[model samples]
Target: MNPWVRLMSKNVANICIMLILPLVFIIIWFYLAKSIDNTVILPSPAMVLQLLSHPSENLISMGSLTNNIFISLLRVLAGYILAVMLAIPLGILMGYYAKIFQLFNTFVGLFRPIPPLAWVPLVLAWFGISSFATLTGVERGILFIYLNNIKLSMVFIIFIGAFYPVLTSAIYGVKNVKKTLIDSARVLGASESDIFFKILIPAAKPSIVNGMRIGLGVAWMCLVSAEMLPGSLSGIGYLITHAYTIARTDVVIAGMISIGVVGALMDTLFRIFEEKKFKWQRLIR
Candidate 1:
């Protein structure tokens, strides 16, 4: 076959394979809904699709679906970014220096096993309904409303959820670096700074990126649970909770579908970057 034609054929085949399971799932869902004959218990796929089709349409009195999703995205990023910023450097140092690792390892190990939800009681007591608005002293106007929606407790929960995987991964990556690489750099008269940044960081970039991808997924997963905390007024998570309260199964399903789609898209972006930037890692394996 011609190269172009072969490439097109391969792409088409991959797309078809990707879609097969979802088509089967929808068919099964349609029949299941028909048999159940209860919109509250099992809404038809069409009902969910209708809500998804009109993404901007308001759900109940909270806000539009898209608006809720956007709010949730912001919350996830707020905590996820904090995790990356703190975890990477700390993890790198801990992995690189024996004393630093010894100093913090016991404390980290003590807290690492605790689930994010387990912190709810303490987090709530610490932050209550306080938000960015409270911290920044923004009392009124559009910004206040936006900032107030982001409760500190929620962010802390998400940070906890995302922190460990990233921290562990960065530590592992840096510690596992070939000793020869550092030795060679030292023999070449490289400064401590040069060896640290030029050798350690570059060698560990792939592992750190992989950790980031996992952290993002964890952070996103924490969203609904975080939003369920006190003072949450809007977000897809809250929307789903509210829909359930009113027996809006269709809306609940739609919210779930939105979360799945968003998470998959985010994962896909990470996968693409991994494949493109770390192709050598694959080849070496």
Candidate 2:
């Protein structure tokens, strides 16, 4: 088979796995739900959907369930975006500078291990019961994650979840170029900028795209943890908590389903972006 045809076949296989596996799991879940004879504990998918569709004061009002979902999403995006923005530059600096890296290593390690919940009280006191406060608390934790990720971005984390693995890969791709190539460029009297942009960045294209996909995955994965702020109504996490308080199993399950869907959507979007942005990067090998 042609290499391109083989690559396309592999892509199709991967997509099929992602789609079919989940549906099979859901079927098993529904079967188990019926077999257990416990409506309260494991509500079937249909039950959760019923709850989602039924009108309730908490779910139906304009300031309804969707409001919470949107609010939580906004918080996650804001916090994640801010953390990533700050992480990338600082990461690049640390990657390039020994003095700067050493100066902040201790501080990052000091509180990096602290749990997100641990900071809730302090963040609440400082920022109060607002979106800012909740997200700020989440921000602190993610900042630490990003900081650590950035510190390693140039090393290996960039390959996994650093700010943008693909970008980092692209950066290193050029740096790893044969010395002869660079020397030849210098012999040609090309400027430093010319050698860098013309050679280095283009070489790192695949790695750079990989980094973005990884970063986006991390951000989406952390969405729930980031939303666990102290205060206010709304969000999948908050919805789960609020529903649990009233012993509303249906509402809680509905929230879980919503969260799952949202998480899947995020991953789906990342995949789509990668496909569009780096279609050629996909390799059968």
Q: Specify the highest-lDDT model's number.
A: 1
lDDT tens readout by residue for model 1, 1-285: 899999999999999999999999999999999999999999999999999999998888889999999989888998999999999999999999999999999999999999999999999999999998999999999989888888999999999999999999999999999999999999999999999999999999999999999999999999999999999999999999999999999999999999999999999999999999999988978
- Provide backbone clash counts, one per model: 0, 8
User: How does candidate 1 fare on TM-score?
Assistant: 0.98
The candidate scoring highest on TM-score is 1
Q: Write candidate 2's Cα lDDT for 101-174 as tens digits.
A: 67865765565455444545555565453433333344456453333222111112111233333334433444
Per-model TM-score, in order, reads: 0.98, 0.65
Give candidate 1 misplaced runs (Cα > 4 Å). Answer: none
